[model samples]
Target: MQATLTVSELLKRKNFEHCEVVAGKEGLERRIKWIHIVEVPKVEHLLKGEELILSTGVGWKENEEAFSSLLQQLITRNVAGLCIEIGSYTKSIPSSIINLANKHKFPLILFHQEVPFVEITQDVHTFMINAHYEILARLETYSRELQELLLATHDLSDLLSHFHQYLQETVVLRLKESTTHIFPPFQQNNSKQWSIIHKSIIDDTYTESKKISKKIQVLGKEYGELYVVVKNRRFTEENMLALDRTALAISQHFLRNLYIEEKKKRCENEWLREWIRGEVSLPNIFHKLGKIDGLHNYEGGGVFLCRKQEGVMWEGASFSYAKLLLTTLFEQCGFLLCITEYRQNILFVFVNKRQKQTWRDRFTQSLERFKKSEAYEKHAKLFSFISVGSFVDRLDEMEKSYKTAQITADICSEQVSSSETLFFHDDLHIYRILSLISDQRALHEVIFEYLNPILQYDKTYNGKLFDTLKTYLACSGSKKETAEHLFVVRQTLYHRLAKLEQLLGEDFMEPRKRMALEFMILAYEQIFIKKKEEKFPQCSEIEG
Candidate 1:
């Protein structure tokens, strides 16, 4: 250990035999703060506490009673000791002064022989200053070691263990409700039980305790706290400062983890998007799946998608609320491997198959529970559609499943009703096929070709031909049923039919010809007409 002079040690120095302790023998081990030589009578102002005062008897020369009072003042001012030379102005030690020193246990040293106060001050002060510097140097060394740990260590637990080694005390890091202990490894055999108790202790610990504590706040965000539990003396300022530096190191570690996780999430999200778009081939997808830990282990699974209703205002608070609710709902299904992403108004959930028998039931129950939950109630007005793709056995088919789920979600979004919002791609195969046809411009033109002439004739003549033709086909060629449905007399319908026959051809209503016209009419209504009506101005139809 580094050396420093104490009161007892200073007394043992050579040429210090002239110095005899008159009182306060119990305080012999008090560390000497500094050596001061003062001849002034009133020296309280000139002395900082903990100093060893060296003086001649000039202050106590005239009155011995006044010297007794000086001893009390020195004790009150909390000095180390008063060392007086006896050969100077006053010869003998005063009895009253010695009695006062003994009463207060204040150290009063008597120098029988002439002593050089200046030389003693020089040696003692030099030693004291050097000791102070030693402490600072040790603290600096600790700080550098901790900084090196921050640079070299990748794991928080490792850094925490090092902090334990340095502090030589139980260090606990409380983050949110999680507690990390330093003395015992975090994964100790008894760690679980200890963690419960230790966490409670940390929570219940006195907030104002003298124990070292520093909140692990960095980059304007407060992560948690770093604190030491020492049963011995209160932490010195050096200890507290050490804890502060360690807290900063922990903060940097946390920030590094956050940045790495964010980058990983972005890369994973982009890869998933590419897979959903079917840009990744089967071979490449299988290769990627091999790299995933549990891809081949899944038994059965599908894609899950959810979104806020279109036109529902996307506010920050509501978006966060929706994201959290959806995440919680899917994450509770333990065996289902899932990765989620939120973009625009949609939350995409990609789930891997699981061997559990109740997986389907659990997923269904979770959905029902979410619907009735407070989270759902808070944003129910913004509820849109929930779509699940067809489950496939192999992992390679997940990309197709995601695409199917997305398509169903889009279709369900447009047809809002009081009906169930959940859609399954397996039940909508026909609609999926219709989606393909709906995307083709040429299909729109070919399907609507037969109706174009009739539409033009009605537009030019203000006739009800188009309406009559629709009702006629809907009635399955029953003229009376068509007239009844259109609220028109049979004679008027026949006249409209004659007009339609004249415009196109008499064979337009023949069996094979009628079948072709009927298919065209259905395709036009399902694909083209509905789209045009939505965009163009409405025209009068036959009254029904």
Candidate 2:
């Protein structure tokens, strides 16, 4: 229904029978929301835009300049039109005023005979009031229908489709890091055009010429945008109001869904925490898995521990965002994950959903993709490392996986010079062996017995003989590779080697000695260096 009275429609009334359009006939479509009578010379401050003015020309009678100036002011004020009574305090219309009205398309109406100004105002005001009432009624109906649909279905796409049907216009919903839903879906050939338009909307560069957009916010955060395209006509204020109502409805839907999902996640996380800590019995674990769909079918699974770096404060929102990001990344690789925040680390239990033995390959691919994602790059500094445990076949064995992941994370914390942030328990060849030895004293003695002479020499002379020996042994006695790895000349490497041979025996390069030295080096790093730099001592235990 039309929301406002237009000049053309207003002229068709009985009160305007004596009125004649003298100029600006092309502006007959201008909207008129109110009617005002004015006999003043300056009406700029009296009228707002879209008000139809009724004047007797008494203020500018017999003065062409005054009439012209008054006409210019009315046009500048953006009034719908001007209706003037002739032959009363105004002899005739001015040619300059007529020309000005025509030039600016400012409607000028001449009343040949005097008509009751009160009657015209009453007629038009009544029509405007009824029009507004109809608009409110329509809006109420739409809102009620939307609320009913919201109750019937929780799908956002269904809501968009209903809005499309109501307006008979194209509707677009663009969500961040998720799919875009277009009702009455666009043609396949126009996908590229839609993408460009979506980008422009996201960049806030679009002119909004043919469409009206609103933001969909949940919990005071903007999640996406809603766009409604007006195909062939200008969008009225009523359309804007309707769009606002629709956005509110969508936001309410999102909030409802979030509340439901959060409640479910709380239950699942409680069970998962107990299961990880071995507090839940195996039978109860199986029973809980059976209760949750798509979880009982898992054939193999693992654990992931993500810890924030030292000095970075913990934020619940950041942890949630990270969990959401990882869930999205891994779910695409055929894995169902149960994530929870435990003690200073965010833990995830991933179960393979597919019936294939390629979980490892898929997990690796997912991790690599996640590292390259924009979410990771934006929040990369908030986390120190992500450690994954070895995959286990049974659901009851996840406790073992959590323990191993903790060990891997500890090893990751000690390697401060390593650029890699991702660690896997299966990949920790020597560190795994060291983690198995529970006696810290025995491990320290093994480290000292293997290379005490080189350690003492380096301590006395403040030399890098220890580092040089480690690098040399790592290079398998390849002098040229060792020199390059150490960023030193061969002469410097030879001098270090000579000093090393003097301190210990030349048998340091022997096969058995080389094995012992490599193992001892790993032991020293895991025991001494790791304990010194441990920031999350609470996370050191498996219960965490």
lDDT tens per residue, model 2, 1-544: 6667789998899778878999999998898878999988888988789999998988888888888888888899899999988877876787888889999888899898989999999888887788889889999999999999899998898889888888887788888758788887868799776765566455555554367899987533577889876544677877888889999999888767755665578667777887888788777876776675435567778898888667665455554555555765677788877788787777889988886589888987877777776656766765447899888887788888998999888776776456877788988887777778935655555566666777777778977888998898888889999999999999989999999888767887888987888777777666666677652122123233
Question: Tens digit of lDDT per residue, candidate 1, span 1-544?
Answer: 2334568888888658767897778777665667777766677777668788887868778577667667776788888888888875868777777777777777788898887777887777777678678777877898788788888878777777777787676777878557555554445677654655465455665443334578886433567887776653445555676787788888888766755544454467667667666577766765665574335455656677766556666455454544445545654554333344556535454444455465667677667867876667766665546787877665557777787777777655553355777777877754666666776755655554666778778779989887888788778889989999999898899899999899769988788878777766655555645465554222322111
Predictions in order: lDDT:
0.68, 0.79
Q: Please count the clashing residue pairs in each candidate, in the order shown.
A: 1, 0
After superposition, which runs of candidate 2 have C-alpha atoms over 4 Å from their true positions?
1-162, 169-259, 308-318, 372-374, 416-418, 438-443, 532-544
Those runs of model 1 whose alpha carbons end farther than 4 Å from true positions after fitting are 2-5, 62-69, 90-96, 167-180, 184-210, 220-241, 261-544
Native-to-model Cα distance after best TM-score fit, residue 25 in candidate 1, in Å: 1.9
Best by TM-score: 2
Top model number, lDDT: 2
